[model samples]
Target chain A: MQITRQEIAGMDKRFRANFINSLSGFKSANLIGTVDMQGISNLCIVSSVFHVGANPPLLGMIMRPHTVARDTLQNIKDTEEFTINHVNSSMVRQAHQTSARYPSDVSEFDAVGLSQYKSTLLNAPYVEESKVRIGMQLRSIQEIVLNKTELVIGEIIEVQMDNKYVLEDGFIELEPMNGVVVSGVDAYHSTQIIDRLSYAKPDASASSIRGHAK
Target chain B: MQITRQEIAGMDKRFRANFINSLSGFKSANLIGTVDMQGISNLCIVSSVFHVGANPPLLGMIMRPHTVARDTLQNIKDTEEFTINHVNSSMVRQAHQTSARYPSDVSEFDAVGLSQYKSTLLNAPYVEESKVRIGMQLRSIQEIVLNKTELVIGEIIEVQMDNKYVLEDGFIELEPMNGVVVSGVDAYHSTQIIDRLSYAKPDASASSIRGHAK
Candidate 1:
């Protein structure tokens, strides 16, 4: 089916949101953990996380317009710190529950039955149940003026994970980590390694990297 | 194992790149097709695509710092048009091959053996093998000062896909579409739908939406 801009613009709001959201394909699913000035912790599932750079160790995620109360965005602005915990297969249900619209005073950590882990370097709490957790310090926040959405960029300050998951080449084995991806608003997915090819070269045929395949 | 920022900064460059890149989890893999001023078609595999907004139908993707010549970014800037085609399982190898550094005059479509599908709605060419293809008009380009990376935002102008792949709720069935996701630089993944739950609510347990589970 072909959907032109006219057809897409004419779509029902809810239908359009879902259709447009899933059009980008599967997204990184993570529980963003944050804390307010009052030391209240907040956790929410966000799938828009993407790599911005690797040298300064930066990561970025999009936050919807602040027309409504957004505790995560507010807390990140207040404390300048947060944790991104990858949503794994074991706790996806609890992770998704964190998306519920709760009061500002209510901590999703306690509300969703997920334990929080704290460290001296950051004010935001981490999801103790998450296998791959990253502690980040707010680097900069850019308001995408086109739409009122905010692009929150953070520098990774701390990373906690099982050493066994890290390969000699430094690639973390996600399948063993049990990390999952999300589509639309509610669908969860598990990934199977489809083969990692060697670095592409203009004159060479792509070949599988030895021992990189599961 | 816990890695601190100090340790990350001190790691070998290659190891650090791999580690930091993989830390963000899986990303949406797509072939961004663009046509230069001379009408030459170009395709490159990019994993940074993410949803920005739905109302105006926007999408954003990061282009590495243009310290080197980048044909796709230059084409989008010159022509103000491009197409994002989701990479599928059947063409994963061919798609990955498009990442190889090619000269400005060389089109990955011809070099990588993928056919281009052109439409009148947009000047950019689309990948004929892709199931979900999006035609976009360049909206804005913002450079991240923290890193020299460029964020290219585009408005969805056209969408072409199979009718059966879209559900009544507007979510595209990715598994049925054979859409694939990428982790780190070279790893490709095929996703299996675990389940699609009902909308999260403060006091309710998430229940699977009927017939949405795999």
Candidate 2:
């Protein structure tokens, strides 16, 4: 089936949301943890996390700040800190539960029965169950004009993970941690590695690096 | 192992790239097809494609326009059109090869041996081997002042896919299309669905809606 611009603009609101979202393909399932001045912890699932830079260790995520994620964006702005914890397959159900519209007074961590682990350097709470955890400091917010969504860029202040998950070459293996991916609006997925390929070159097809190392 | 901001900044540049890149979890693997003024197809791999909004069916991606992706960015800026194609497990090697630094005069489509399927609505070329294809028109470019990279936002002008991949609820099933996710910088992995979950609500744990249907 082929859908044109005019046809897409005319799609049912909810259907168009699911369809357009899926077009972006698989996304990182991360539970972004934050806290207000009163210390009411907020945890919400975000799928737009993408690497921005490395030397500064920055990551970026897009959020409709005025909608379901208003609290997350607000908390980050007030505290200038947050924790990004990867949602694994085992915690998928609980992670998805964070999206529910909870009142500002109620902590999603308490509502969903997930433990909040506070790191030493940041006020943002981390998911104790997550194998991969990152603490972020708000760097910049760019307002998207066409859509009101804001692009939140954060600098990675700290990264905490198990030794087994971090390989010798600094590549963090997700399979061992049981990391899960999100598709469209409400679908979750598990991935199977197809072997890491060596750096590409114009002269030849890339070769699989055994165990991600030479 | 726990890594702090200071340590990350001091690590080897390449090592830091691999380490920090993995912290974002998984990303969508896409082969972006664009063409020059002379119709020389430029295909490149990008993992940063993300859903911006649904009403206008917008998608956004991050690219370092001044670097390896200069050709693709230049073509899109000049022509204001591009095709974003899913990179399945089978074509992952070819997709990765597009990242190789090719001369501006040479088309990556010719260098990589992928057939270019031109859609009537846009000047860009699509990958015939891709099961999920989307034609995008440039909407706006936001310069990420933190890094030199620019966020390219595109309106989803057209979508083409098999009927089977499009569910009744409008969720495009990527697993059926053999869609793969990328981690770090060079690793590719195929996904397995864990079933779509019901929309979250405050009252209960989200139950899996079998086959993405109620």
Candidate 3:
């Protein structure tokens, strides 16, 4: 099948969104946890999480235009702190529920039956059910003018996870954690480690490392 | 284990990079195909591709700071055309080899042994081995000042794929294509579709959609 720029522009609104969203393949499934000044908590599922820089340990996520009330973006701006929790297989249904539009006063954690976990060093609440939770401090925000979207960059301030999942070379073994990946807005997937190859060098064949998988 | 911000800042340089890169979980594995004005082609693996917006069909990728020569970024800036090919399990090793630091005169395609495919509509070369390929034209570029990374946004101009992989609702079934996902710098993963759920709504459970997966 071949789809051109003209055809894509002519597609139905919702159809184009679904088609374009899934074109990039599976995305990291994470729930962004934040809180307002009044201590009101908000949890929204986002799949745009990507690595930005490692020295400062920055992670970036895209936020849609504020055509409606964007509680998660607003909360992060006001507090400058948020938590990114990996959505696992067991909590897929509950995590999907967080996408529904709830009232400003309503807390998704309470509405969806997920617990809020607070760390001593960060102001935002983390999802207690997530096996991998990261506390981040807002580093920068860039507005994408072409589409009114905002790129939110945050520095990883704290990481809380099981020590068993951390490999000797600093890679996190996610298969044992049952970490889920999202396709489009509806599909969820579980992954298996095919292999972890050693660092690539010129004129050298990539070799697999043993005992890296948990 | 709990890693605090101070501790992360104090860790060794290479250790921190690996730890922080894998913290975000799995990422989309893709080989970006680009060509220079002289028609010299280049292929490099990138895990930073994220959907910017569907209305404009824009996709964004992060380019690390050009502390050293960045052939991929330079080629895209000069020509404003590129192709994004989804990496599959069969070509994992060759895809990883593209990440090696090859000099400007050396084409990774030749060095890594992948065929360059060109379509009539787009000037950039695509990977013939890839089951899914997207042709894109540069739309915008924004400089991330804090980290000196560049966010390159491109509009999806053409899409060529096997017709069977696309679902009725526009989501592409990746498992049948043997698409691979990358974790950190070296790990590759194969995914299994747990289920495709219907659109979320308030006061309702997410039910699986039948006949969505191939």
Candidate 4:
């Protein structure tokens, strides 16, 4: 159907605004700093975690647009290091608190009361309470011209996760982690375990369907 | 941890060949071709649908990077036209067949056996089997570097959905439509309907909670 620009803009304003301002549509623990030569620490809670590639195990997170200057963005760019911590239900409130606009000098960990630990290979800190934390080296940052948003891509350097959450093969049990799915904007959600279907492939024959019959 | 280029390539190859290749991703329903003086049709499928903007109702999809000669991509690019059809569970097999590398002169709808209808305002046709079809105008075509991927961004010009799937507010009820989620290189997925949570926002508070609760 024919629609005017005004109609399209009106329909999208609310969803767009919510998407930009909301925390993670899905909650993952994000650690806030890098370790210094003297063991100094910095911290922030970032919610833009995304898997950019599988082969090299790359992960990405978009920092809030650098309105003034952002510490997490700066540290990742300067030191080329950071860590991603998966936020479970227990860390929801604390993670929310980290999204607050604090001064550059402030430590988000101190503000939100979460313990930090050194990353295995990277210079960044990992959230001690997180069920899974991944250390990464910044790969590249692309400025998405359409929206002026920075897409920060990182290469996975090392991974550390609580064994309890990993399956024998590598499937992650996301339910117990209380992974949240973001919707309209700033809401938090707890996911329920639904049926986990067997993997399906494009060329698999009928025999492959047997495993999923269960 | 420091990994050699060999290791990276090995992991990338394995991930692309196995893990990603074994999953079920989306196969989209797309219609192409301009209606002649007499109504003739050309319809097909594209699996690379993606979102480009929240504001202005923008969306994007990647076409065969080498479609330098195919009529589908050419028609969309030449006429600056196309429609997006959301493939429901019922259309899975037919949708899959649309991907066959047919000659430009052949219509997949005839080859795979499906029907097509004209879009309301746009020149492109719409797959009759699709539950949700959106007519869009080409905004830009960007070629991704180092890859045979062409990112076609579009502005959502008009949307048509089964009334049953449209919710009280503007939120589209995606469950009944059996919305397919795409991943990796090639696959088809039927998503399990998780709980529909309230839209979250950064500014959410007890007062806003009460308002939504009502």
Candidate 5:
């Protein structure tokens, strides 16, 4: 369809939100993380999380513009540390509860019935019930003015995972965790391993299509 | 299980690889519009892009990092204009081939098999095939310390997307596009629609667990 610039701009504004909604619709789990600042704790749900770099071990998450002060952003800013916990089917409901914006002084950990555990190297606490947790240090923060959003980049400092999800080579198979994927907004979807393509760089040999279709 | 700082760091490094690998798995489609001080033209392709916004939209992507000497980045520096297109299933193959690294003067539309269109306000071009795109003006360029990485961030000026993908009240419905999800290093996963969640604001009304099964 021929979409104009105005149409596109209108759609761009809702893309992430709709994607998140589509994602949440599946009743799939959302990525849940906990942040603590000066003893104030908060739980935040994010779906715009993605890896930014590998060499420096970085991950980036785009946060919606905060209409009010947010504990997660405040915590990260204050402590320069945070924990990322992978949400699975088991923690979907509790994770949803954590999305509630409680007072900065209140702990979402208590509201969600999630146990907070001290991170290995960071001052923040992670969700004990989460199947996968990674301690990260703030590396950068940039504002997306077009959307008035914030992108948080964190360098992975540590990782905690249950062996059941780890492969022999240490690859974390998120499948069993009932790993949920987010769409635009408010949507939660489950991930199914459809096809595992061979890793091929642009300089490498093109993938052999024969016997490779899953 | 408890994880140590050193152990977490080790896992963090490896997980970083997997995370980036997963991102690489999904092909990114964007318009490489060029302006030779006067005219603007759009080119489309799927690149394994990365974000460098250590601060706020200080976004960056690893092109051939060498490709910068060519047209896109050159144009951005000369005119400080560019755009980002988020690819969906419809243009998967088209976006994939746009990464062929054509000569500075060669347009991917001619090199690859995709069509291009001009932008409205920006002098750059937009991929007719992409469903969503962000128009930006160049902010800065930084070369990675030891790697052939060129970090580029632009001020987002415009966002484009299809109207159907947009819902009333400005929510984007991304599922119909059959948005392709990425995993590993080259795997492209198709999405399935599920449920949508309400925005998880501190005071947003709590979602009902009526249909949810733990």
Candidate 6:
């Protein structure tokens, strides 16, 4: 079936939100951990984080700074520091719980039963149970004049994860860390490797990386 | 292990690239299909597309407009339209092959052996094999001066998909489409649904949606 924009606009509010959200395909599931100026910790599930560049190691996320993610936005603006923790398989429910509109003084980490850890570099709290945690410093914030969403770009100042998960060939095996992805806003999933292909060349067919297949 | 940015910069080039890419967790795997002025069709892999907003149904992507992805970027800019097709499990290898540096006159659709079909609303071709295809009209393109990457924003004008995959509650079941996601630049995987939880609320624990769990 083909759905026109007008038809989509006419759909029920929640239905349109769900339908539009799922259209982007699978999304990264990470908990954005921040701390307000008063030292109250804040945690929320943010699926918008995506790689911006590799050399300087920047990550950018779409945040409705004026609305939904105000706590995170305020914290990042107040402290210019935050943490991104992968929502591993065991932490899905607890991570999802972070999306609740907890009061600014209430720490989602405490309310949701996830432990907090502060890395050596950033003041933002990290999820202690998360296998992959990154300390980030605010690099820049650009607002999309279109719909009031802000583009929050940050530099990865530090990364803390188990060394065993980092492969010799440069890839980090996410399966070992139990890193999960989400569909729509609530469908959580873990992945099964379909094989990693080598760099593509016009004259050659992409083959599975050696020793990656059964 | 804790790796500081300084240490990350000192690591081998490819090692740093892979390690940093994996830090964002899983990414959406989709082929941006477009056509040049001469109507030369082009297809390329883009994992940077992320949901920007829900009301206007906008999607944004990070593109190095000056360098890599020049073809897809140029085509989208020239035509003011494009298609985003979910890279399903069966099309991963062929979709990855589209990333090769094919010349301007050569259509990647042919080189990669994926069939293309044009919808009534857009000139850009959609991947016939893609279970979910979206026709997008370029809304705005902003330059990320820091890295010369452009944030290409598009509005969903039309969506083509099997209505059966769209649930009564509006969540589109990706598993039925076999949608695949990427980790790093080349690692691809299909997902196993852990469960779909209900909306988060301050007073309750999240439970799997009825009929969505075993």
Go through the candidates in order and give the clash count of each: 0, 0, 0, 18, 48, 0
RMSD of 3: 1.7
Taking chain A of model 3 alone, its TM-score versus the true chain A equals 0.96
TM-score ranking, high to low? 2, 6, 1, 3, 5, 4
Task: After superposing candidate 2 on the true structure, give the runs of residues whose Cα lies further than 4 Å from its correct spot.
Answer: A212-214, B212-214
Candidate 5 structure quality by residue, lDDT tens digits, B68-108: 32566667778887766666666555555555555555666
Name the better of 1 and 4 by TM-score.
Answer: 1
Lowest-lDDT window of 10 residues in candidate 2 chain A?
A205-214
Candidate 2 lDDT over residue span A51-97, tens digit each:
88876788999989777789999999899999999999999999999
| Candidate 5, residue B17: lDDT | 59
lDDT of 5 by residue, A1-214 (tens): 3433344345544443343233211122334354564576676766546555566666666565563226677778777887777776666666765666677677888766788887547678888877777777888776755445676778777767665544433344566566666543345555554444343333433343323322
Best by TM-score: 2
Looking at model 6, the pairs that clash are: none
Q: For candidate 3, write residues A1-214 as lDDT tens digits.
A: 7899999999888778778988887799999999988889999888889999888789999998573228999998999999999999999989988888888788999989999999999989999999999999999988999899999999998999998888777778888999988877688899988888877776787788747543
After TM-score superposition, the amount by which residue B28's alpha carbon in candidate 6 deviates from its true location, in angstroms, is 0.4
Report how far off residue A22 is in candidate 6 (Å). Answer: 0.2
On residues B103-184, what C-alpha lDDT tens digit does candidate 3 reach at each position? 7778889999999988998888999999889999999988988788999999999999997877777777887899988887
lDDT by residue (B123-152, candidate 6, tens digit) is 999999999999999999999876778999
Query: Model 6, residue A136: what's the lDDT?
Result: 94
Model 1 Cα lDDT, one tens digit per residue, B85-179? 99999999999999888887898999999999989898899999999999999999999889999999999999999888788988889888889
TM-score of 5: 0.71
DockQ of each: 0.86, 0.86, 0.79, 0.17, 0.26, 0.87
Candidate 5: lDDT of A138? 83
User: Any idea how many clashes model 2 has?
Assistant: 0
Which 10 residues in a row give candidate 2 chain B its minimum summed lDDT?
B205-214
Model 5 misplaced regions, further than 4 Å: A1-38, A62-69, A140-151, A162-176, A193-205, A208-214, B1-16, B19-72, B100-105, B119-123, B133-162, B200-205, B208-214
